[model samples]
Target: MRLRDYLRINVWLLPIILILLPITLIIFGSSYLSTPNTYFNTQLNDGWSVSHGDNHYENVNLKNFNLGNTSKGDVVTITSTIPDMTAPAAAIMFRSILSTVTVWIDDEQVYEYGKDFADKNLMLPKHYNFISIPESAIGKTITITFDVTENNAFSGISPVYYGNLFELERSYLQSKRLDLFIGIFLCLFGFMLLTLSSYLYMYHGQDLSLIFSSVISFNLGAYILCYNDLFNFIGDNDFYFCIMEYVTLYSIPFSIIVFLVSTHPELNTNLAKVFLSINILFPALTLILQLTNLVHINYFVTALHIMALLEAAILLPRLVMNIYRRYQSRKNSPDYTGMTSDSILIIGLVVFIFCCVIDIAKYNFFNEFGGGGVAYTGITFMNLGALGFVMSLFVFYFYHGIEHINAAYVKEHLEGLAYTDPLTGLMNRAKCMQYMATVKGNYALISIDMDNLKPVNDTLGHLEGDRMIRCFSDILKQAFDGASLIGRTGGDEFLVAIENPESGICEKMIEKLETLMAVFNDADKKIRLSASCGFAYSNEPKLTDANSVFIMADTRMYRIKEQHHEDKLSKFLDDIISGKISQKGGEEGT
Candidate 1:
């Protein structure tokens, strides 16, 4: 409920948001109001030209333009020259015909396509030639040859040449260095924000679902802008933006649903079910559209991203408000409360929504208003949501964890009242069976019976016998403190189990019982009570279950009590017979 509680979780998440959110704004949100004037500057690197007169056998379609074959005579001439030759960067070009496509610079075979070139380099694709010429190849005249070999595919057409994209050059030299450096700077800074955010989620024990989703968003951006040339790192703009496009595609919807589910725990189950089903369906549909190229799923995703952000904006506040109200009522009442957790969660959700909306507005609306200056809000706000998410999850998990511990305590305490004997405070017969059902391992079960307990009840009254029962149960508790379980199975009966069967413990315990009997009567007016105990230890796992152990102990105890009773009866009969014989003899002699 208080601000200190919010900070506990917020402390970790803030730095990440401060770093990443701003980057999100600068990279994507920067052009929101207007495109920057700097975007007008385009540095051309791999620019080449071919006149209509330059080709001998040319096809209107550029596909496979470099290679063609004719049975008798096939020829195509290419006039090659490198721009910025003094700059010392090799300009690469390639041509292919039939089985062979040779690459040349400075009039020599720098790379051969579809040949032993595979052995020389592992990076080379087996089916295509992606050649590179060193900067040393510049300032020299170059001749290229694409000799037709076997001509199995196209034996009768002459070779032709076509244009390629501008990529073969990179400049360390700064004709326009400041502008380039600035763009790179923004990107690096943005990347740091993104990385910081990810670390917060992974390290702070936050929910990984949205963390992973946001990570995918960041990855999408890097994939589009900063990958290597093997995938045409600077391919046609259409293909090059695919990664960014897909990033928006999946992450937009994913982020929305993750926010909804994590932040709203009390939604109706039916509504949640429907929403979750649709969530799965939407992603799958989008993936299908992408893989098949059935339609440009990017368009839907981008449009949906804006919509989803708005929905999150609306839903997040409502949920937070509800959590706050509930927390206020429950804070100190102890019914069930998690004010700090709810507050952190609400704050994170609200700030994240606001940040996202601002980002969207900055990109689509503000960027269009003018060049990049008026439009793009630079990244710096990421810390808000980053910190919020961390705190929210911390609170969320903590709330649940504490609730679980309390529940366990309540259940155990309540169960003791229900199943335990009131007088002895041991488990009753019902509890004995329950314990037998519940417990396992090697144990010693002791079944005790007071010798001639009914006669004491008859002579001294039931109250005195009851006191004896209570005393004996207390003795059982003392004998097996932490070593075993002592429970009142029924009237004058106790059941106990000890782990790993220390049978010597039984002897010491029985001796203590005898000592209690000797001292117990004088203080209580000459009422003597002795108990016989039978116990057995089973080492076998299968035989060590409670029921089997109890039966064995009970059987052993009965045998000891029966033998003592027989000895006492025999002595009493002998005394009576001797007394009667002496009396008859004395009477006859008189």
Candidate 2:
């Protein structure tokens, strides 16, 4: 996980928030429990005159009260060690609209009422007696005339406890820059990983690799947007925010291109080209308008952010269809069928995207759902969801890569086992037909017969005759490879198919077979064989064309065989044996 990726993923909070939740409560125990402070020891005398002071204010009117008074506009401070509570997600709610402000031990004056500091970093501080001072009552800095002056003052303390945190953190935490960097790095890292995986898939045709690569790439773009601080360090925050928004929006469309390229039928290289060409110009335009203050909307950059998420959600149904089709084609493996990693990844991304949309809607458009009557601010939450989804994407990709490896293994074994003939170790008729269907353009189908093999099978051992047939098929396979798809169509008959017969592939095969025959029937050999081949070619469809191209070839072969004299089989075999030469010589001749 790189810093950028983490920012991209979390954007608002830490990754391990579930674990951190409890720890947060322990540290900020007082914040969760409605403070147990009783105004006792320090007594209060109502009014005082602070006709002068420095900073931001002068004399101001205030409601007077006693030491035990607990009302609006009361200024209270922690005089002793505060009591600790288990729950951290607690807040002191004032009656009406009062810009809630928090006075932290670190001198961090956070606005609890106004829009500025509504975004919270912690859920609740478990221990500490938080003095709730409503911002509505104080417009100016008044003097602390008496320990207890205002009607809402509480000087002493007593114990109290009301559990269950009411407020949820709605905003993304703008904490340490390091946290943001981690987030941004992780997303970018994921992007890099995705690019690597894409290359792997392109070369090796691995689905998992493509998916993993896509996820990483998506995260990378996201993280780049998240590392706004890094960008700000170089320039302006608003400028940085604009670039981030454009990138975030662009990633949505860009990811669609990547997804299609990785899985689309017929492979859509053009879509990627189109998106790349278009989007390269978009970010610059958006950034320029944003920097010039031309687009001064508070959540101007947010529109694109929401759009990206919406698009992700929209892509899910199409992906589901792809999964269904893939399963139909890959029917045998029911257990490993349909919508694997890609589906899961898309689902997670969609949910995360949707959540982001909600976040934007609540904060900017409408706050109807929950928290702050809009979106809750403070204490990171959505970022956790994003991180969770990212992790899921990682796992999905890892598994997908494994699946590709498994598929390659299965393909290799199947090619060796189910397709190749055991007897001649050549292609069976079924495999031959399959190969024949794939050949394009003008091609030849040939039938070869080894004469005298049947008689030899009856007179000598069938095993020896079988060996003779095997030898002839082996010779034929080597003779017509560039020109042939060879198979044993019968006990003593073999078939060969080749492409682009205009190159004289048929004649070359026959000539090469004759050479192989001579080598096979050496002086030391037991039984010699002679082969007859017949082939036909046509631009227009023959009765079989490619389907029965072999049958037509067989007919021609038989015509040649019948014309020979009865004593010719032995002589023909003798001629083949005598003419054949060394394996090296055959190679050189071919």
Candidate 3:
């Protein structure tokens, strides 16, 4: 119906179309990309033998193979025959966690990892091992040795795969494509939020909630990408990514706590302060210990987990109670709109906490009961929770922003009403006084008074008098268009102030006012309109302030009014003496 309505509808529709287009294409294209290349890849799971100290196991299925009663420094050896394959080049791929791996094909060493780190008592980074298989050794017996570097580091060997390297990599990445997309999206989104928050903080002086949100999103995204070995596909720097994984993991809780405390000040209790301090100090201490080789960063995972759970347990209930109280207080109020944001935040926090608890419980369950190892698939319930939480925060931020804008607009409107004159649409006396008190520098103050206003009101009615006043005010506004202030100080009095006026500017403005009055009087012959105006410059001798200049101008204006009365009286006498008016009419006007 309207152009603005059309534009608004398009604005809403365009983003949806843009978002769905790529998704539709990806959905259709994924079938082709996700088709498995079974001929080039094979999982080598069966017919493996394992040997430990004074023990041997045969026909071991490598999938979740239990390394019963293992300790640090205990060595386990696995042997299997390489499957026959006609590929030009092939490799064996498996993931190693906190262990040193050595592979040999018929007594010739092929690939080794973590040996140096293990020897130096340094923490070993987890990564996938892709050992190239010689074409001649396709049917050769392969001996794989795993030296355990930590207690219960892994209770089972991961399923190994024999495949073309590129094909194996492709398959692994295909399985994790969703994780990749979400992880990258979160990282980029976090970066954009971080940049936006920084600008608002530095320039606009906004609060820090968005900054904390950005940190939470970016760190969680990075942890997901690294923990699942998905980062290996992007950058194969195992040690750096491993460090990033731990650092980003530790940073998430810190950012989350700060965000909660900043957004809801009631949550910033003494206990919260202590947790905040610990979050800051503990991560730095662990990093120092890891760098100095005294202890590995991984050693504190359980402690970190416990601390996170404890922090949530202590703070979540307090937050819930606070939000509940606020909701109850405003339940019946007409302006109650904040509950939506509060509910979103609460839902997000609950989902995030639930996911965290699930992940922690699953980790402990698998490690203690199911096996000694946990599989990280890059995309977990925790990722979903993080996304949910961040989205909720974004919604809250936008809603809060809208509320702030609305408040500012209402405040500005009220201020305009307070300072404006209703009748003539000019600044009222209060605003004029305010400007006069603050005005500075070389300026001119023009005081204006309408002539014969009382006589006009008495002869014609008050309405005609009001119209005359309004007409004169319009003329003053036009004449003083470049002035700093044009105000109706009283019913028949007005003022114009100009700052740093050029030479002869006041004279030019006065002449312009006279010319406009002449034009108005010629057009509207109901009343002969006239006004007396006098201006005083701030730079003149003995003029110290705007008020002083205004007083001087008012004094001059009264003197001009007296002179106009004298001239009108003298003209009337001349008309009578020249017999231009009859003797009886002249006596009646007198």
- Scored by TM-score, the top model is 3
Candidate 3 runs further than 4 Å off = 1-39, 50-71, 321-343, 376-379, 434-447, 450-453, 469-477, 482-486, 495-511, 527-529, 534-590
Q: Give one clash count per candidate, in the order shown.
A: 33, 60, 0
Q: Write the per-residue lDDT of candidate 3 for residues 1-590, one digit (tens) a residue.
A: 43233334555653675478457546743656596775568888789988987789898876656565357888889999999885546889988878899999999998999989888897778879999887889899999998888776766677688888888888888877766766777798899999999999999876988899899889878987887778877786888888888988888889999999998998888988999999988888889998998888877888989999998888898899998997797655433443346777888889988998888887776555554246432236787677667777786786566546655665666777998887788889999999999999888998988887898899998999988888888888898998999999998899899989999998899999999989988899788789888889999999888889999999999998899989999999998898878867778899
Q: Estimate each model's TM-score.
A: 0.48, 0.48, 0.83
Q: For model 1, what is the alpha-carbon lDDT of residue 2?
A: 34
For residue 16, model 2's alpha carbon misses the true position, in angstroms, by 17
Residue 334 of model 3 has an lDDT of 36
**Model 2 per-residue lDDT tens digits across residues 1-590:** 43223324552443475468546534443334333333211111222222111212212122221123233344433211122333344332211111233333223342333223123211111112223333332222221111221222222222222222222111112222323543565567676676776777689666653564455445544544443333433443433443553455545445544655565553444544564455445555655654564542222344455545544454555556666677566655623423455655666666665666565554443232232232122113335445546655665665466566566766776887888888898888778878767666777787887788878888888898888777777777788777557788778878777666766667877888888888777753678868888887745365545666666787998886775544576776676788644544788889
In the order shown, what is each candidate's alpha-carbon RMSD? Answer: 14.5, 15.4, 4.6
Q: Report the lDDT of model 3 for residue 354.
A: 96
Residue 114 displacement in candidate 2 (angstroms): 20
lDDT of each: 0.51, 0.50, 0.81
Model 3, residue pairs in steric clash: none
